[model samples]
Target: MRVKDSATDPNAIAVDSPAGTASPRVAAPRTGGGTLLAALGVAAFSLTFPATVWALEGLGPWSVTTCRMVLAGLLAGACLLAGRVRPPARRHLLPLLTVAGGTVVGFPLLTTLALRTSSTSHAAVVVGLLPLTTAAYSAVRTRAGHSRTFWAAALTGAAVVIAFAVRESGGRPTTGDLFLFGALLVCAAGYSEGGRLARELPGWQVIAWALVLCLPVASAGAALSLRTEPVHLTGHAVAGLLWLAVGSQFVGLWIWYRGMAAIGVARASQLQLAQPLLTLVWSVLLLGERLGPAAPVAAVAVLVCIGVTQRTRS
Candidate 1:
């Protein structure tokens, strides 16, 4: 997920950054550190699906989702308090809520639910669409115009992802597939909104504030989930849960949004093209899942499409 500034011209394409912040425009040069930061963020996120799967072995999806949020929120709150950060301006409240709803609530819940039925490998393929979705949301939010080549590349990538899903599921969509798709959309929106706010607020602070904002809801949900499901935590499950709370939800966004703020959303988002491949590797190594011959082919195709889309001018 990412955020940035809006364009003055309705037809002009601009990357979202904080107002008064400097970020590379589409044609501008990108910094090496920004690219590396974005890559690191992707590497962190790549483990999310598999980790969630490991977590589910000992906990219900609701338990994992809500507990992760509550824990991460507490960490974020501590960060805020330690930094002595003032509350956001009243005007910033709604966007922070948007970030909270999509990422803090929607993405984790939906993906965890999806993982109940879907393999980690399949979910990784679905998540491959995230960069494209984030780009689309950024385009709409910024009211930016895209060239025909850009749209064609974006549509082509979408088509490839859809086809891969269909082929994987024996030509029929599964419940997990639907849930993962929903996760992709909501996460994209959250990323875009958070990236936008990162311009004015520090990237870490943007997610920290969003997490803190949702703490009450997260606490309630976690309590209710535990009451209903009664998780018996194992060492692996505990590790998985902590990874989600600290690595993916908190530190990952700290790096990701900063990369987006520095390099612009478009370029930063492109780095996520590597995410699916990394996820596939993690799934096989960590989860002991076997990769089919088709998996690598699909991953390469998706990466090529993403590269094409990234190169197209908006």
Candidate 2:
């Protein structure tokens, strides 16, 4: 998880093109609006897991994930058509393919599978480790300077969350929890790399190519799953699946990646902290799940960890 701070890199403000109209250039200043928008994106995504779980009662996880991607891809394709976004250059095809597989196909498949056994709370707890995982990956990959205190705090927070989740899961980690954690680690890598690519490529274009690249994989998965387990159609299930496909996947991502491109990955990721908290809220309101007495405790601890990790000199 990263924040999209323009303060760190003035060059990221805009992409200049030959057909451009005259535009003014200036030093990137801090904007509270970016943070606010990022917060909204996180809030939207927080509803995603619980929404998936709720929808999953009727639609299977694979079906749900596939449908979501398919709808999102189509929506993105439409946007591309309307905006006249160009296709990727031949040289860029391979890198785009790699990101498509990692970000769209692999991450969603693993996460949807995880949601099958794990409660929304369980998944949230594991995914809350994303800040640590992302920071570690960034440090190793870029050799970026970050504080030891930040890492220590992130590590401690992750440990505490894991401990609580394990206790909640009856001392044994569920397959779902493990899958969620593993997916977070893998997806964070893709997200970091993809964000780097956004420096040279348009945000929607990257995702458009990725979704196109992922279509075959998603189609194959859908075909295989549908062969044995036909999706039973019910009104509630259909409605839920529609929400997953259109609202969560398509609408949510359109805002998310665009915002990430406009800002920066680190700052964009700061919005991610809201996801777990929103999941908790949705679970309580929609699913009637209780966070028990540990809700406030977990909330405070997580916020502190995020604050610690966010203490960057850059």
Candidate 3:
């Protein structure tokens, strides 16, 4: 989540040392393509909150969440089948399940429900905390060391986000705020787990397998939700749903994992700092949400804290 310099050289090939030598091989610097791919992934993800709000105009949150996951699962199944990838080993099964539950079920469902009451602008600002959360999860899972400065910056960023949430909710936390907080925590766990898995498997394969693993539950939920809430799909809603299914769920993760694998998670995740601003823009333009003066000021403060966190190291 905290951005760092790329860990390896994408263009470098491993050169064999002398037969008796035990020197480790060094990787070349990463290419510019990795940065571009990461940027594209962030761009796709930035629209998610706003798009969910739009889709909710014509469909219930449960229906929208379930349908999006089911659709994305179908596409993931197709990719796995076409790629002729074998099922993951037993050790990987649990991590894959974590990814499935976190990204496919927890994050989308909670955020969809959250948008029912919270404006996209508020949600976008709150999402500014994701990079810090993701970094914390990654550090914990990997047993990586971090400096006190890093912790200080991350905590400050999180505190700023919490303050913004409180201000937006009139000094009291709303149900939507709780939902969004849950979404943030689960999504951070998923992103960290998926990044670790991407080192062992193809990035797309990791997500595809996770999606396929959750297919049965997602399909059932979609059917049950549809039965309970009659869907009246409008043009805007359809477009929003399609974007969520294809871009946010599938394409974004595919490119994101590739970028993470190529440049390392910390460096690649830095690109996500742009997501809140991009989401705010989408909310204002596409969803016609009005931005208050406090929004920009809070966003800048959060971004500054994030930058500081990214630059500090263990």
Candidate 4:
């Protein structure tokens, strides 16, 4: 994530162009095109919480989570097979499992459960801390260093979300907040690891492999849950399920990992600073959730913090 200039940092991943040898203007492109890709990925991910809410209209929490994974896994499997991708080497298995456990199982299940009790707007703000958490994970795992300015900004962003949660919940966090915070932790770990892996492999391959690995378990869970969960299958519910499967889980991660590969993990993550605000707009427009005045203030505060981190991170 915080790749020291590849020239100086021996541990930094060498990013070669498609021809195997790359241009010297790596830094320029990373800041430009890479940032754009990450921004697009953020836009895609912003809809996830609202989509999950819509999905809950017709499906049980467990059913929605499992069904979402199953569908994404199938799509990922199709992509892999179409391209005749080779199986991952044994060395990649553990990290792949980590990715699958966190992104595929942990984040989705926890957030879905939380959505049962939480407003999408509230949930969006709570999960807004993800960029800071992800950058922290990337720093630790990669043993990269960030400037004090970067840490200060990141911590301020986190503090804003925490304070907002407390204020909203009458000085105490709710069950939904707890679930979302847990989702925050695991998802950060998965995202940082996936970003790291993306450097060595194609971005899509990383998410695809992780999703495919969980296909069997997800399918089984979905099948059993379908028997127990009441379902009405309204247009909103079906559309939400389709978007969650294809848009958020699969395509979004694919784009995100590619961005992480192009830029560093830390910088790409900062781009996610705007995600919560986007989700807020979606919650209002799509889900018709009302937001208190504090939500926008906190969202804008977090957005400002990311601006500092992007400029100061080194």
Q: Of the candidates shown, which would achieve the greatest TM-score relative to the real structure?
A: 4
lDDT of each: 0.76, 0.63, 0.74, 0.80
Q: Model 1: how far is 1 from its true place, Å? A: 28
Give the Cα-based TM-score of candidate 3 against the true structure. 0.83
Which regions of candidate 3 are displaced past 4 Å?
1-33, 156-172, 294-314
**lDDT per residue as tens, model 4, 1-314:** 22344311323555544456643321223556767778889999999999998899999999999999999999999999999999986767888898898888999999999989877756765566888888888887866788888888878877787676556545644568789989999998888888777766678999999999999999999999999999889889999999999999999999888787777778777777778777877877997766567977987897898778767746
TM-score of each: 0.85, 0.81, 0.83, 0.88
Ranking by lDDT: 4, 1, 3, 2
Q: What is the lDDT of residue 246 in candidate 4?
A: 92
Worst 10 residues of 1 by lDDT: 4-13
Best-to-worst ranking by TM-score: 4, 1, 3, 2
User: What would the per-residue lDDT of candidate 2 be over residues 1-314, giving only the tens digit for each residue?
Assistant: 23232223324444333456422232222344444545565776777777777667766777777776776677777878888877866756766765666567666777779888877777776556665675566556655555567557767777766665555445656777667766887777766665555555655577666776666667777677666565777765676667766665555554555555445555466446546766877888877887667667777887776666456433
Q: What is the lDDT of candidate 1?
A: 0.76
Model 2 CA lDDT for position 145: 53
Per-residue lDDT tens digits for candidate 3, residues 1-314, read: 22232222233223223354332222222536666777788999999988898789789999999899889999999988888888987767888888888887899999898888877756765566777777777776766666787677767766666566456545655568888889889988888777666656677888888888888998898899999987889998998999999999988988787766665565455556667777877877997766556767767876787577546544
Query: lDDT, candidate 3, residue 105?
Result: 86
Candidates 1 and 3 compared: the better one by TM-score is 1
Model 2 regions lying over 4 Å from their true place = 1-31, 90-95, 167-170
- Model 3: lowest-lDDT 10 consecutive positions: 1-10
Worst 10 contiguous positions by lDDT, candidate 4: 1-10
